[model samples]
Target: MNAPASAIEQLQLGLPELDWITDPNRIQRLSQDFSWFSPVLTRQLEGKVADAVVRPRTEEQIRQVVAACARLKLPLTLRGSGTGNYGQTTPLAGGVVLDMTSFNELLWLRPGLARAQAGIRLNEIEKAAQAEGQELRCMPSTYRSATLGGLFGGGFGGVGSINYGPLAAPGNVVGLKAMTIEPEPQIIELRGAEAMRMHHLWGTNGLVLELEIGLAPAQPWLETLAVFDDFDAALAFADQLARAPGLDKREVAFLASPVPDYLTQLAESLPKGCHAVLSLVAEAGEEALAELVSAHGGRVSYRRTAAEVSKSHKTLMEYTWNHTTLHALRVDKSLTYLQTTFTPGEYVRQITELSRRYAGEVFMHAEFLRNMEGQTNCSALQIVRFTTEERLQQIIDEHRAYGVRINNPHTFIVEDGKAGGDLPEDVLAMKARFDPLGLLNPGKLRGWPVGAAS
Candidate 1:
């Protein structure tokens, strides 16, 4: 529910020059993200809306809104392009949603690094970096619309994660500028690990203003699909490709059997009853990739040269990562997904065993990535045939029993969605220091007591 209209009106009147969206319908629409991806989150976050939205075009304007909200003790939720799936942009406590898209600007670009305002879109940054013969080291599949800040605040890694790991990995995110929640907002500069304290906290710890990120040298990536009749062969090919240090690749995903069938757009390429490994490797490594596919008894079913993909503006990337879930949902509405990490060396065995255990119930879809400790493994975003919430929890528990870590996506509570048990004391302390009154995304961080001050 929205806060009192009078309060929102008062905020608007105070900042008469600021851009405000007061239309209830538009406000409601802007209040939501892709959280509807999960039936559980859909139900829990139902009817949650921000009282109003403010689109600040300048850093000065943002400070004004921040100060006013803090003085009024109003809950504030920071938002970007709203591409997140876990209700990261949803305002659990009705107040103000600070829309940051207008604040976008590519601050500067240097060799192996670039800095940009929090609202800059990932694609925009990539295009700019590409002009400099560099590209983002890691970005989500929704890079075209997802903002740099949105990815930093709520995203793990995607696409290029095989080489760089997640956004939280050391050196990926060099530094950031954040604003504390207070009447007199303090703009702080945090570097290295200090800046990452706010990472993946769902924007509950502090408000990020700008970020400096590392970049990878540009490559002409060849997008292809290696199809195999045998599921084990497909998994092995993807695993080998991920572990092959000599083959330069951006992405490697295994879509087993029925999972490939769900990608209707790629139906022609994804032959019936075949497991597929979608990959993005350097154009120069095409012959090597083909050799590996043949070694594993598979065939290249689809091929799109970098130039063709660039001209057509279509790539297999749109059909991998969480995009796979989206396409599957489009084809079959009765499906949900799980976020899981398998034991590194045992990933293939674990996936093989689980596929047998669940078979038709859980469709195996894995993305090969390097973990924080630089270990090679695959994180599975398995598509499940949703029957009931109880059954979903059971599936998660069973996976945990099999030694796979499940990061529950169904919960809006920051700590609950995480794989680890509870928020670290340092994380809680970060929240207290940056958001003393707990006014920033109030209900999302369960560890903080409401209205508490440092």
Candidate 2:
């Protein structure tokens, strides 16, 4: 059930001192994310919007909003930049959207580590870390506006994942400060593995206030693009770069034929009908990268030094990841996308086979990264030609039959999104302990029904 009308009034009256937004248009916009990427999700969440919004500028203000919402039993959905594509910030039950952007602040930065308020943008943290000769270990393509809490709550690793694996991999996140949802909020600090209990749950388990993340030494990365006439040759080159230990690389993205056609902004570098491999390698690895490209019969079509890239304010990082889907959608509104992970030692073969099996239908777009287990593999964000819901499910089933792991992005429920159908007992226990009333992002967590007691 949605929050009672009387309860919303009570919440507003209780937190009269904090910023409360009741404008319908702004509320509608704040209630949405990039979920429209999926035609399935777009229809499913068509009219879902929060009844009101509250922007808390400080930890104390956040406590007041949380405490009031808890007291009134109002369903509260936490929102950070709203850069996620899975409708993560969209509220299934109308109540209040807690906008965390205004609370942004970088708390501290030291060598190899940084702590910042949950609402701070990832780019801001990276800029601060760079001043200390360090950078974020893993950041999404939307890092320019994506928030720290948003990533920890709803994202997987990106760019730097090839070296450090995913964000969930140990050592990437040092600790975090969260608040328990109660009439009297309790500020709690969790460190090491314990802090991760709230990671990737879409902020349903607890309210993250500030995050402490691990950093990596800064590298002057050279952005380069390799274009090939052969699909097998392109995938092989990217896989080789990902596996090359001597090359200090940050990213290796493979875009199979026609997929590159959608990236109109890079038309000069992306020749028509060519499969592309985009990467960010240290200047020291320039020769090795060129040799590998030549060995695969792929030619370097684009080159930008780290300094040049900084001046242009454009990097190939934006062309990879989900941004590929955005560009594809811009070209064809009927197109959708899928998230799949190929088998570890067999990713290249699987990709080549699938590309052949579904040529002209599922255009290949893969990002190479080490898994949580430190095994290197390529995860695909393949572009799909939309036909019908049944066809989408059929494609998913076929990929599964071929041993590919599908992390379905069309669903909003936490359990349904993961390959696994249920959450861990420990994760549920964290939810029970932190949000007893289930007021935090209520409808998203499958294991714990809204308002169900521990």
Q: Estimate each model's TM-score.
A: 0.97, 0.97
Name model 1 segments beyond 4 Å from true.
1-5, 449-454
Candidate 1 worst ten-residue window by lDDT = 445-454
Instruction: Count clashing residue pairs in model 1.
Output: 0
- Compared to the true structure, candidate 2 yields what TM-score? 0.97
lDDT of every predicted structure (CA atoms)? 0.92, 0.91
17-103: candidate 1 lDDT, tens digit per residue: 999998899899889999988999999899999999999999999999999988888889999999889998898778899999999
Model 1 score (lDDT) = 0.92
* Steric clashes per prediction: 0, 0
Task: Name the runs in model 2 displaced over 4 angstroms.
Answer: 1-5, 450-454
Candidate 2 positional error at 186, Å: 1.1
RMSD of 2: 2.3
lDDT, residue 12, candidate 2: 86
